[model samples]
Target: MIRNLLVAALLAGSATVADAAQWNFSYVASVGTISGQIDGTLQGDANTIFVSSLSGLQFNGTPGPALPFLASASSVVGGIPGPPALSLDGSANNILACSTDTVSSGCTSDGFAFVPAGFFAPPPVFFSGPAYGGAFFESYNAANWSITPAAIPEPSSWTMLIAGFGLVGAVVRRRQVVTRAA
Candidate 1:
């Protein structure tokens, strides 16, 4: 039992804490500054869905099919309008190190990271920061950039959780039958 408990604890810790480290930046056009909140969920969770690295994070309008969820990888949040080549300037390459999760301080050129058309789910653009840095995104309103504290749960987590509990129940039933026979 002790061994099992230890194993469980270790697995839990690894799932939630292993990847916890530095942060990166994302550009939310609405906020206009870097903050911590890629879309609505937190990318900080290692187990969750969050881009592990970000180099030059910027997107204008990229048109794709309509998807309800968001993307921690795609620089183009699906179903936007047009990722019209960013309006670059001399400042395009001047990326700030570990800057805002949204709105790069040096992104004065491509100030508009993601300009939405109607309503896209996860903002409509994602950028990765060096694992040592942080990963974040701008809010829908364009207030400031925010960090995605952890990874968000995809559809799989929920399905797995339910199945795990069912397994536990089956084990308990088998033990009960054995005890009654003895």
Candidate 2:
């Protein structure tokens, strides 16, 4: 009986390790509405793993280009203290390229960044201009930055849970069989 309990406990614990989450983020910016899904493990203080890897990214209504490796330090997820929100930094250290057109493969001429208050240089936030001859730069504040938790148990987690239940069921069945024979 103790062995079965121990096995169940270990399986339950292992499921926690394989837990994962997906956060859908959206907010208005000077350029347009920025939105995407961030996929990563929701384990506390380790949420930076989802910073650079953004999916379903869109600007206004157009799809954004594939992003390069962004700095994890410039972003924050549910793994830290504060409101359940996602904060992205596009400071000089983390220059995030703003995709303006669907044809460009990279951020050759345009870029934007979110400089957290009191973190980098002054003026808080700003958006840069496009590379197609017309140059423009403007400063704006980013508000309503929403980051919500959408969790899904990993496959290994489900497997471990099912196996644990099966093991416990077997143990109970064996006990019943022994009692009936006696």
**What C-alpha lDDT, on a 0 to 100 scale, does residue 97 get in candidate 2?**
38
Query: Candidate 1, TM-score vs. the true structure?
Result: 0.28
Local distance difference test, candidate 2: 0.49
Q: List the candidate 2 regions with Cα displacement exceeding 4 Å.
A: 1-21, 39-50, 72-111, 117-121, 128-137, 140-142, 160-182
- What C-alpha lDDT values do all the predictions have? 0.33, 0.49
What ranges in model 1 sit over 4 Å off? 1-34, 40-149
Per residue, candidate 1 scores C-alpha lDDT tens digits across 83-149 of 1221111111111223333332322222223333323353433333333222244333323334433
Q: Which pairs clash inside model 2? A: none
Q: Whose TM-score is greatest here?
A: 2
lDDT of 2 by residue, 4-73 (tens): 7788777766775334467676656545666677655443544332343556766666766544333322
